[model samples]
Target chain A: MRRPPRALVLLAALAASFFAVPLAALAWRAPWASLPEVLTTEVVGSALRISLVSSLAASALSAFLGLPLAWVLARVPFPGRSVLRALVTLPLVLPPVVGGVALLLALGRLGLVGRALESFFGVTLFGTLPGVIVAETFVAMPFLVLTVEGALKGLDPRYEDAAATLGASRGLVFWKITLPLAAPSVAAGAVLAWARALGEFGATITFAGNLPGETQTMPIAVYTALLRDVDAAIVLSLVLVAVSLLVLVTLRERWAPQA
Target chain B: MAPARRSLGRDAAALLGLAVALSACGGEGGGGGGQSEASRVTVFAASSLTQAFEAMAEELEEDSPGTSIRFNFGSSSDLATQLEQGARADVYASADEANMIRVMDADLVEGEPSVFVKNKLEIIVSAGNPEGIRSLEDLENSELVLSLCNEECPAGKYAAEALDKAGVNVEPDSLETEVKAVVTRLQVGEADAGIVYASDVASAEGEVEGVPIPAADNVIATYPIAQLTDAESAAGEFVDFALSKRGRAILEEHGFLVP
Candidate 1:
């Protein structure tokens, strides 16, 4: 192996520092002496519980719904497939606040379908735990769909075809052969979805509304804390950063070992 | 391997150039001669003052050619935090005395802030008052979805006071970060009722209706304005204009009670 150019290495180091400096600053300003007390506060505890429950629920919902969508997108060859893919992945790139507005329009009490749901079933998702899950799933599911689709498309087709040739049913081949082969990717996708959902702020606040012990997740807690208590906000931020770091390290080691 | 490495380095260099070019494009309107900088008076004001401030800015710019007035509108607490964190601005206006005091305590204000307007809280509901929400007591109905500004915001503080005075105990479904968000929630029909400044209801232009809060139960919010310590020479001029007769008229038109 040859050494990289000195100029390229210098630029790369500068780029890395750009991301590192802010995290370092956050750590520097953290209230280390009071961390335990701050962490034990009811606000922090409630926000943590809400964040954990909603993010995990969002990930489960994403996997349940995304797997089938991914399989279809990867295997089916149909007209407007590209358009369908674009529509499905729109949430991945669209601003989360805009996604929240769209959600309110579709599912809000006075919304097109929201009105029907409210009148027929007396169900209103706005400002509820279910609303937070819905908003998170809307933004997180696209990650799972895209990731699983890529993995599904990358799989060798010979095994499935061979299984089918041996007089196995489609369901049997899918259950015994396809799923096991894609299990690792599915797990990776679910983790990515969970991480994205954990950090969700805009959509949840916009759609689900912020109420402590209910819709107020960690990110929202940090924001609210920043307005009145900078120290508390810093502590909450550190918690989020620690969680995100753990997720990244786990992903690198267990899911993308080759990288 | 050497050839591939060289091509990769070249591509990286190209990417770096594109990034620099894009940043240059993004900076277009913000960059210019020192003359523009001197003429640019950036005023950070509370979100409830958005409509009135914009109108004042238009008139001020029209009266003084070559002068540009830029405004940053958000929750008063958030703006105060930003000013304390050294965000550059010519003038600061807060929705309540508490936030103004916070900035003064931080020594960010050039002089004492003067109260320029007084606003009272009102119950905001969808157009036609579908839920027939007539008073603060109506907000307590469990069937109605209520939204209020988070307690960290001035509007929220005022709303809480008013609700307390009215002896109403309502658990809001969501606590928004800004007064405008509360209005948006009401406008979008996601919330059945919310408490916001009377000016906000007037600014909504019939999208929502305001149910007057009896003066006995309403809490008044006083808006204060001051030039910042680091303000440019023109900063004082903008502050003066906001407190002028014409400025007061614009605010009054928007339902504010000019002091």
Candidate 2:
């Protein structure tokens, strides 16, 4: 194997230490003796449960909605397509807290559409599970969309054309050929989206409001704990770190693009 | 060869860890203005003190030319933790004594924190009081969406205590981490009612209306300010200035009661 350049290696080593030291410190001071007791509390349990449900729901919704949006952005050349794509990925750059405020403006009780929903059906999305899901989806969907779009763009279109010539319906070609070919990217995107949703804080709290066993996901729970008990916050954070590491390891092993 | 590969793997892990760490720091605002020239003072304060502190900063600068003041504002609990984490700030002002005591216990401050102001809670509703919420009991109606600060927040703790005293068990749709967030919820009309400081209601102007909490049931929120041991003499001066009559006038103008 060729030796890597020395300057690059030194710079990379400095960056590595910068990142590794803090995490090492966290692990070192994690209150190891009380970890089990702290993690077993009702608050932690509820927050963990809610985090799983909301993030999973966000991932599923992103796969369902973002996939089609990505396909359109990649395969179809239409007027203002670039604009549409920018809008789709806007949330990726927008502050999640600002996204939450936007969500409230669009979906809250006094929101433009929300007022109608309230008067007509008495359905309010604020401070509910659906609201959390919506907030997470809004913030996380952009990850899936951008990922899948990149994948779709990179796919060999000759295969898709070959299927089309075989008298397969457009929908059939999509379901049978396009989706399977894009499966790895879709899985990768979903996992990335799920991770983002799981760690989501600003938008979720801003739009859905934090209510324990209602809308208080893990991040909110950890934040609340941080305010009162640093030990509890540390334990909660350790659990999150563990979960994220597991997911990243799994993704790297199973779905990472081979060199 | 195996050792080299292990080190490479560790480097990759550290890089990934650092990426996560950097992302978190990016989310939160940092302390200090990064000024090299001129005497500088940095104050970490509760979010409720935003307006008053901004005004005080101007006043401080006017009194002593070339003395620049910077501020970091958030929930007091978060500020205390930042101090504990060794964030570089000259003075610490908290909305509650508990958080201030946490920093004091850590020996972050030079002397006892002086009570600068007292605040009380009020129920905020959107303009017109659309829900016809007239009193604390009216907030308990399951049909109305309510927001309150998180239990870890001074305002949240006080709100919970007052509610308990009133024998009202309201299921708030959201427990915002900051008292300001509760005010935002009410301002945007996302929540039918929210509990926040009277100062918040005053600052929000006509966007929200305040329903006075019965004085007997309402909890008084005391704000404490202290100079850090590591801060410059200017930090001590600023703290004294904040506790001075002129500073009290600025805070009172924003609806905080002088202690």
Q: Per-residue lDDT of B76-147 in model 1, one digit per residue for the tens?
A: 765675555444578999988988999999898997888999998989999999999878898889999999
**Could you give the C-alpha RMSD of every candidate to the true structure, in order shown?**
22.9, 22.7
lDDT per residue (tens digit) for residues B122-163 in model 2: 899998888888788998899999999888777899999999
DockQ of 1: 0.02
CAPRI quality band, candidate 2: incorrect
Cα lDDT tens digits, model 1, A1-259, are: 8999999999999999999999998999898999999998876876776676678778778988998899999998999889989988999999998887788778877677877988899887764567888999999999999999999999999999999999999999987777767776776787789889999988887676655555678998886665434567889999988877875775555454243
- Each prediction's TM-score versus the true structure: 0.53, 0.53
Looking only at chain A, give the TM-score of model 2 against the true structure. 0.93
In candidate 2 the C-alpha lDDT for residue A54 amounts to 77
Measured with C-alpha atoms, the lDDT of residue B154 in candidate 1 is: 77
Best prediction by TM-score: 2
